[model samples]
Target chain A: MGALNREQKDMEEQSAKHKVVHYPQKKNKVKRNESLKSNAIAWAFLFPFMLLYVWFMLYPIIQGFFTSLTTGSFGMAREFSGLDNYVRLLSDQAFWQSLWNTVYFVLISTPTIVIFGLILALIVNAKLKGTTFLRSAFFMPYMLSISVMASIWVFILQPYTGFLNAILGQLGVSEEIFWLGNEHLAWISILVATLWWTLGFNMVLFLAGLQDISEEMYEAADIDGASAWAKFWHITLPSLKGVVTLVVILQSVASFKLFGQPWLMTGGGPGDATRPLVQYIYELGFIQWDPGYASAVSYVLFGVMAIFAAIQYKLLVKKEG
Target chain B: MSKKLNIKTVVYVFLILVTLVSALPFYMMIINATRDTKDILMGFTFLPGSALLENYRTMMEYVNIWNGFKNSLIVSVLVTVLSGYFSALTAFGFAVYNFKGKQPLFIFMLLMMMVPGQLGLIGFYELNRFIGTLDTFIPLIVPAIASPFVVFFLRQYLASTLHPSLLEAARIDGAGELKIFHTVALPIMMPAVATMSIFTFIGSWNNYIVPLVVLFSPEKFTVPVLMGFLKGSQVAQNLGSMYIGIAISVVPIMVAFLFFSKYIISSISAGSIKG
Candidate 1:
């Protein structure tokens, strides 16, 4: 989420200001006492959250790394075999397939969603009538849980009795097409459902970015006889660079974590054709009862995501710097 | 002007078509939820049938979806409250106090926020099993107290909006530090907390994977998990009931989103820019 890397800098600046504001108030002894009291109070305030944060988030991250190094299932004693799971992962075919599946999804969905989002944003930012309705209609699906989105798609795309086929029948193309049965069409269906489900968030972000671009720039382009295409290519695209990068990184990270839609819609069916790496991790950990290998695969996912996140951080710094 | 009007008409027509594509599935779901399973299998229709009660009866016969709704609501509300309060307190602590390990600690939190959630799945499962909190809502709900993104947003919010003079005023009035936080800072952070709360609530409601892995009992299933269960159950035999089941899970959120569409849209905008 906070894909930008400058939060620490911003926080330091904030703390520096607070220090300057409060430092003038004291001599050494009273200031020491005051500092002690504030420190105690601050820890007390932070304790409740920090306790949970460490237990839930921070501890699990470390535990996951350790778990990846061991050979065991849950409830079994873990034998510490250093790099054993990672070594096995190198030869794991299912892991490669699922990882490739996930990468293919990220490659397809990220650009599709971002580009369509920009188009939708342009339409919404057109200052046209009925854009309010357009905005809500586009965004409304994003609020639904993934299961619900999958359900609606499954209902519409299911063979023989599917709504899509029924409509297609009337259009003189009558065939019992199993949308989720074949691997390629299943991926396409998943992509369409995903585009419907998530394109709105990116669209809303782009709309915000577009709105932030001053109208005067567009007016200036218009006076210079810039065509609509030229204005969009020059003025609009450049101004949206930051938000575009953010949305792309966020969307790729999200797409890389794809599990729910395929899980619910097709159950990663047709012989795990649509299975993403997260589902692979789930199958390993829960279904096959191998927490060690599962953690190892998860770390691979973590590695891929960390690389993307690093790229995002670099882009953010380059833009701002 | 007439040529421009023609282009406008074409654009409007295109938009209306897109809206149809967007909304048609929902309309079909709502309509087919009222149709007979046989009628639904026969062909899709725009008209509603008199089988709404029958579809609901069939769905209820298989799964008590309302129980899942209740479970989702419980988890979502608890998560929203706990995350909001603790994130506010944590943010306030970072904002007002200059303390030890404060800078590194906050930075650690920001870094952790970037780690994909699935990375910790296996370990989180093991930790719950180790602690014996498996098959319970505790795993789903208790972890909300340390939502890093919420804390980050709230901290930035306080930085720009909350003034130190106000905290000093509260302190000079003999209010204790925690009291100052409660009476002074919490109210100031309320608006930002509320905005983040909507996301927190929705996120917790839609949290399927953790609940799916943790809660094995049908009685304890959240709505999303229940919908997945419903898909696998005999209720899928009845397409009408299946449609009704999905609609039942979806329609309430749709209605609620319509109510807060403007606020939610703006929050997404603000959240993106700030993050």
Candidate 2:
């Protein structure tokens, strides 16, 4: 019998056995009836989330893949030119440049966040006076939205009236530096904003990791006459290996979605020097009205991020092995 | 002993200095909001200036930020309440029920969490358009009701905390199924739910790109979107107004952060470990 028919038959048998076999029968029959009720109850509760998830997330993902294979802009009749969008993406310079810019950002910002986060965690995680206030201070910036972060940085990095240059002016520097206008400096501005805005979460992760380390280890190191750096290098580093790896992977994933800050701060300006791939996708789809090509570019980003998660999972498995 | 003291001193001093660096811009934002355009452009001033009311006036004059604030408040609250309640209900289902296909279905949720929010951008935008809900708050608020991360988080919480015996007791007392969830499971799940609510509210409030993509009308815009327009829409040199607008936009979240910061921090840390 087919699976559905078999389940129906089994369920009917259980119900009939419960009815006819009476109170003296095995208790398993009654248990099966209760479990069947729970099954219906579960679906009743889960149905809303499942409905929306299917409608919004799953349907869109499937649609996005289908949309990627088509050749059309918005409002145009979609022509199923199989893999043409992908083939066209292969030679697109804008695609390559945005990809490179995003990768470059991921490369630069991930380390800055990781290294600085570790140091910040170590400092604030110390049993020092007023570190509570210091912890709040370090994390306060992360609470601001992207627009607020971008605006603050812009106000601080503007050529003449910027706070950074004003401070520099008092310190015997006379020239106003256009921090957001230059090609290299714009990336610097983005990295600074990103680092300021996000490093707090990384620090918290490290702090959690640090807190998980046992006090006994510190005493053990002390008895062995280990130095501070020596203890950190030996005990702390090895224990935090998992957290460090998790943080690194998490940071890279966050960095890869580099749309809001760069888009707001630079407008992908000074000749698209700071346009990340996500921004490129937005402009291509929304501005140019090319959803097919945009979905194609998106899949490229999707594939790479999937690989990032896959690599982390592989590392975890290898560690377990 | 002196060497260790020196290292400790260095660490404290360095941390203090860097902490100042972290807070300086937010300080500048708040402080600069009080200064006039010329005073702001003249130089950075640590002291409060006299343009606070004027700047606030100018911000309201052009941006209609109050309207945006109302819209944002509506969207964020609806999204939070809906996502929080629905996510918990779903978690309770998975935690209690042992239906066929449960494992595969849950693995699907885990996979959903792994996929970044932006991956389905094209399809989502198009789907909204296809459904004729383009430019509506429904597009923004409704999808959030099915937040996979929230589901995953709450499920973990429920597994550890929820007891089957409590539900069995509720059933024995003849409480309805939904009533058991509404009263029993929900009350037990309040601490975790409250922590997740703050995050969900903040996420919805601070959301920029989704609203930016979908929203077209000025009145429908969220605060973040308006923050951008307040700067970009400076058909003239009204930079001071923009700063004040941004300062206004930031204060609510900052205050919210200060109020429930410990819970927020614990949630993020727990979220990472769970992920």
Candidate 3:
């Protein structure tokens, strides 16, 4: 992207200096010297950021990988046990449970959030009254922090005094259900909370994609006496294909990092039923003080996300090409 | 025409239903904030109650949520400022300068952006421990300077909108490179900077896990961490106070979001497409 920009910039500069073409050799020397000079200057500007980036971003990655191969906690001397952490993780029950939980969340929540977002976007994008209100209403929950969202959900989902139960009681339900105490119910609650909290973001993305689809296409479709379903099926769906792919990939990547909601809502339980891979890494690295094993699990997560990222990058590049 | 009108009516009804579902929790939160624990326990009510001061007093007795607010504000403001200025600087460098290894460096940053943030959590914790920066805001604040996604967005914004001829004109008029960046480019990029800054501030404000892991002190805890603390503490027993505490964290941002909803929504839209 940067190289393309620079090439275009060079072309612009050359065209702008069209009348001064007689000094080509001198210009080339000056340009070479200027390139070297600009390199230093650019580095100067980039230096402050690079310093912090390397320390925090780059170093931690390398350090995390190194720590994974060792056997110790932070602030202590370590012994190198080559690939032992990885080998152990291969058969680790808790690790597998957490991995499955995270993937399950990605599987369930990603599609729901993306599809619902598309529906919301379409609803708001309709030629109707009160869309501004509709848009804000849909997106407002997204503005709150995860903790707040979890608190509200927990308040509603808790057994006896919970809001949902109260509503159910008015409708003559007898038994008081423990929403977060049962394993399956707890996952459902987390999924519901996750969807409500994040669906707005995907909605906005789809709205953008919807707006980009030209009116002329729809008008032409209408001229052909296409029904609303026919127009949506043939034009709207195809036009939104890119954004849907982008949202799906992004949502899945996000869902894979699930922690805060379940961590707060159920503390990853009814017996670790909702413990995401991230919460597992947190438990091992922080609570248990086993930095080596935690770092190993972190790498596994990085590996999983890298697959999604690679696909996203390939699609983005293809679109650009 | 009647059929079309019927479809529109159905669509409107569906939209209203979604709107109510979306806003239901918030309505309950507000109503519950004014109700005492006993009242909340009795059942949910739509009417306002008279325990607002009592709830505030109870919550304040347990936790200084205002302190958490202050800590969160300080950290988020600094993170936003550092991320915006430094990202713009880095983006300007990449956008304008024909530097050696620039392509590789930019690509490296892009790849790093794709790396899940949790990948570095353990090592970052260790690094902070090693450097004795754990329990300090340095771990949270300093990392904002190298925000790759912000830089990527800003560079893309600059690539299309910024003209090299403008920089050349500034140079001919005796402006230094840095001066031109500040005086010329920065102003042009302010809209984008402001757009990105909203996300940065919100991201920092809502960051939970990092602060939970790094900061141990109650007074230094950010809003999200404090919310967790509130859940675990005695405050959770008093449902009204707990609702009020959560509301205190949410309502201000909710109002701000409403005020800037159009801009914020547009920025999200633009961000996804550009991103």
Candidate 4:
């Protein structure tokens, strides 16, 4: 992308130069030296970030691929067992369940979050008296750390004494719902906490997108006596295309990395039902001390995220185009 | 007109009710933090209970909040500063300097934004172990120096705000490249940096998984790790300490949000939209 962008500029610079009088070779040499000096300075600034990036992130990623091929654990000598870990994962029921669990989360959470975000954005964006209260009330949860949020939700969702069950009882839910004890309820608990903790961010994003839309379009619609739904469909929805794409992509990528809420809330189950792919990798690598197999599992997740990201990029670029 | 007024009233009521769902957990937490384990079990209460000091005492006994607080502060502050500054410098390098391979390098870094950090978790752990920094905070704070998202955001910020003519003027006035970046450019990027810093601080302060994996020592655990410990040990037998622990972890962020949320909210949108 960068190369193509710069290539056009380079051609423009050359064509503009072609129309100029020829400069002396010595002057060109001095310009080259000046460019070198700037390059040195640019590199000087870039060195620290690049060094850490390579060491902590880039190198480890490449090494992770190689590590996946072996049966070695952390810092141990490896016996070269090619594709063994990958083959094991093929038959691993837990791994497959975790994968599906993560996908289920993304699929369910993404649209709901986006739609909820849009609704909240519309409400708060209106000239309402409770705008400040509404905005902060919705977004405050997003600021809490996952452990903190998860802890609060656990308090709210525990089987017998949970705040949520108590509230449900007030609304005539006589049975004490085992929110975090039953498998389905456990997943629901994770989803509810996640939705509360995260919806605020998407709301803010959609709010921004909605706010950017010029009021002139809406005013025109108003003069034409357009209904509210019609105005929303024609002006609001179309104008929000960019932010919607961004929110979808960012939210899905984030949801795919789900670990903390489920991990802390139900401890990854009523039995592996809510265990996300990331937590599974953590258990394999840290608990079981099988770094090789863990890395193999991680690569599969990485590939999935990369594909989503690729589609997101395509959507973003299409919008830009 | 009456029907329209009724519909508007319905929308207002609906919004406030939705706000209740979001805010109720927080209110319940604060209220219950004052209640005993027995009171918490009986039912949710509308009022505070008398166990506030007792819960605090209980939490202090189980988890070392001081150690967790200090460790989290150190990690978050260091990560925020390092990431905010270096990311700006890297973005500046890309925005202003015309160099060989700069475009390709910047593009490579852009692609890096999409790569999940979890992809390299095992490798990072083993790599850190190989280097003998396994349990230290080195693995936790060092990697944040290369935040691709911040670099990407600030690069876009700079491209629009920073003009090449300013650099030419700085050079004409005898400022060196580094000095120009520091004096002329840094101030201009300060707002973006400050915005990114808040986000970085909140993220690192709340980061759980990396610390859980990298640091094994109980004393070195951050708040999230310690909170997990608190829950695992006490939620079944006594949740008073767990409630106190949650309050301790969440209240600071809630307080910070109350104080500076407008800035945080504005910054959140600022990065997404073109200036």
Clash pairs for candidate 2: none
List DockQ for all candidates. Answer: 0.66, 0.53, 0.60, 0.59
Error of 4 at B228 (Å): 1.1
The per-candidate TM-score of the B chain, in the order shown, comes to 0.96, 0.93, 0.97, 0.96
TM, every model: 0.95, 0.92, 0.94, 0.94
Q: How do all the candidates rank in terms of DockQ, highest first? A: 1, 3, 4, 2
Off by over 4 Å in 4: A1-27, A313-320
What TM-score does model 3 achieve against the real structure?
0.94
lDDT of 4: 0.83
Output the worst ten-in-a-row residue range by lDDT, candidate 4 chain A. Answer: A15-24
Among all windows of 10 consecutive residues in model 1 chain B, the one with the lowest summed lDDT is B159-168
DockQ of 1: 0.66
- lDDT for A195 in candidate 1 is 97
**Measured with DockQ on alpha carbons, how good is candidate 2?**
0.53
Cα lDDT tens digits, model 2, B37-149, are 88978888789989899988877868787788899999999999999999999988877666667779987787767677777888999999888988899989999999877
What's the candidate order when arranged by decreasing TM-score?
1, 3, 4, 2
Docking class for candidate 3: medium
**Alpha-carbon runs more than 4 Å astray in model 3:** A1-30, A311-321
lDDT scores for all predictions?
Answer: 0.87, 0.82, 0.87, 0.83
The candidate, 1 or 3, that scores higher on DockQ is 1
